[model samples]
Target chain A: MGDQLIFTYIVDGDDFTRAGEASSSVKNKLKMLGVDSDVIRKVAIAMYEGEINMVIHADGGTITVSVSDDDITMVLSDSGPGIPDIEKAMQEGYSTAKEEVRSLGFGAGMGLPNMKRFTDEMNIDTVIGQGTTITMKVYL
Target chain B: MTIGEIQRVLDAQFLYGEELSDLDADFVFSADMMSDVLAYGEKCSILMTGLCNSQVVRTAEMLDIVCIIFVRGKMPDANMLSLAMSKGIAILATKHFMFTACGILYEHGLRGGA
Candidate 1:
């Protein structure tokens, strides 16, 4: 990693309507920075999914994004209930999201898989009762 | 086909981005589920959905989609419209349901994104 430019955002759990604000902000910043479209696309998609997950599954969380010469690193930390089975959660179409969430056009169990698909690296740290933190990186 | 052509074929109304009406797109993706859109929608320039929300515009932004058509007479509120406009995504609304709108476009030779 080269010199890093870090951006932090708070994902509000109370409002489902504002979930993607952070991702949108990051996308605009990356665009202004003249990053490649493909890299920006990947980061935007991965981070947006993480933001939605925070609002839907967790109460809310904080995200830290670091922009470097070689890659962009995103760390999403939430204080909501943690995943009991990371393995199961990784499976596509295996979602624990409620019916209401599905109606909102999410909770299709594609969030995690899509995040992994768009990022070069991903790691999840979770404790059942404590919370979850997901780290994802997209290489430039 | 051009977005303007699609608008004419469907008799749709432009809620925003009339300036972008002439833009052309090779592919179209229609769905109410944003998750499906994220997973299966690729290389689509126009997104047609009945699900109206801020996330819909956000999803289009992430995918680099240039246009959005709200189907089944669904009209996005002011907030959604403003967000879409700011992101430079043209917004269109049609009375035709999701299936009908997509079918009309397909009949006119617009292909699915797949």
Candidate 2:
């Protein structure tokens, strides 16, 4: 790739089954662009976690990905009950997910942490009742 | 171990992915939570989970996990099975609990990821 490859997706909140489509698509695109396998994995995991978070907490949102020679950047924005405590949410294993969500195999409070773990840089912007936006970058 | 051998070990029922179950895998990672599995680097080729959801299949797809074993006699929903099938991921369910199923596989020579 030259400067960067850009991708935009709308995550659907209604269907949990389809939540990972965006991240999967991004992963595929990165692979096709000849990005490193480890880089692709990081993008996939971080974005996949963000996608699920959008569906579970934010009722879906939009994800924008920009791929460049040096790095991959993902911007995820969701309109939901904004995070009340960013610090608490950042702590591993602190989850406010419903029982049904936990049953489906999520809500371990690892979403934000995984995002941070897999990315070179990450930033979160949120309002208590409005929405939240997460930006993450993975160096190639 | 191949998916076929795992089936034989747990005496699991193949819910989908019969063709893929026979593929040999060097390692196995067992977990119900996708986050834990993701945190586990890309070493394990097989995944064992009691959680039945599309996300489980999606997680496998993301991590390049070749097979998923649903323990405790749990079965996947139609959508989940279809998703796994589309990804060429073998799905097997055993009557044994999570720990027992893993123990049987480990005793037989299947090791965790490096």
State the DockQ of every prediction: 0.84, 0.77
Q: Candidate 2: lDDT of A90?
A: 93
lDDT of 2 by residue, B22-50 (tens): 69987988888887888774788899988
Per-residue lDDT of model 1, residues B1-114, tens digit only: 888888899999999988997899989989988988888786889999999888899999999999999998998999999998889999999999888898899999998898
**lDDT value, candidate 2, whole model:** 0.89
Which candidate comes out best when scored by lDDT? 1
The local distance difference test score of each candidate is 0.93, 0.89
| Candidate 1 structure quality by residue, lDDT tens digits, A24-107 | 999999999899998998999999999999999998999999999989999999999999999999999999999999988999
Worst 10 residues of 1 chain B by lDDT: B35-44
In order, the B-chain TM-scores come to 0.97, 0.95
Error of 2 at A104 (Å): 1.1
DockQ leader: 1
Stretches > 4 Å off in candidate 1: none
Least well predicted 10-residue stretch by lDDT in candidate 2 chain A:
A1-10
Expressed as tens digits, the lDDT of each residue in A14-119 for candidate 2 is: 9988999998899888888888898888899999999999999999999999987888999999989999999999999999999888888889888899999899
TM-score of each: 0.97, 0.94
Residue A140, model 2: lDDT of 80
